[model samples]
Each structure stands twice: as C-alpha cells, then as structure tokens.
Target: MSARDWQKSSFSGEGNACLYVSAPDNATIRLRESDEPDTILTTNPTALNALIRNAKAGRLDHLSKG
Candidate 1:
C-alpha cells in the first residue's frame, strides 16, 4: 500500500470527503477516503467494474441517504 501511488477522484469537490483510488497490486484495487487513509476497501477488478457499471446506470441510486 505504501509503495503504490494513490490518486484522488477528479469529481471530488473542495471538501474533505474526497475519494482516493489505487491498485495495490496486479489483482486488486484499493479505495479510501482522504479523511480515513487507514481504512481501505479492497476489491477485485471484476467486482469493482460491476460496482462502477451499476453506479453509472443509476441502479444503486436507491442506496443513497439523500
């Protein structure tokens, strides 16, 4: 985790609620927030792509608190 470079989302606004993403290795993607660097969420490429696709299709809009 320390060796790889983490990048922030371009959509992240001028707030502390920033999203960071990186690949820790060849097989896994790591996601974390700017405020909680220690808390990382790891997932495989397949599942991560599925989540992105579902999110883009508005299939997961219902999960929002707003």
Candidate 2:
C-alpha cells in the first residue's frame, strides 16, 4: 500500500503518545501508536466497531487489570 493519511484525535493535543488511525482501503483499517510508528495493528471495520462498543460498555475493562 502507498502512504496513508493517518489521523489522530484532536483530544490527543499534539504528542507522540497518541493513537493514529488510517483507512487505506474500504476493507481494512490500520492503527498505530505515535511512539511506535513502525509497529502497526490491522483490523476490519466490523471488528473495530465491536471493540469500540465493548470498550465503551466497560466490557473490556478487565483486560486492563493485572
């Protein structure tokens, strides 16, 4: 794929510790952290939406605990 226009949330407020996202194609979504640009995480729209929904519902909060 060619270079993508990655976007970060405005709430991130200019820092190298935010998450960046890009939709290089209709079937794929890409994510990466500013502090680790070389490492990317890929997912589809459906899976991404599921994750977001679960997160907002607090269903994934247990994963963050030790």
RMSD of each: 2.1, 1.8
List the candidates' TM-scores in order.
0.80, 0.86
TM-score quality measure for candidate 1: 0.80
Which tens-of-lDDT digit does each residue in 1-66 have in candidate 2? 334589885667676778888898898999888888889999999999999999999999999999
- Candidate 2 residue runs with Cα over 4 Å from true position: 1-4
The candidate 2 region of ten consecutive residues with least summed lDDT is 1-10
* Cα misplacement distance, residue 41 of candidate 2 (Å): 0.5
lDDT scores for all predictions? Answer: 0.88, 0.86
- Tens-place lDDT per residue, model 1, 1-66, is 662589888999877899999986889999999889999998989999999999999999999957
Scored against the true structure, residue 46 in model 1 reaches a CA lDDT of: 95
lDDT of the structure predicted as candidate 2:
0.86
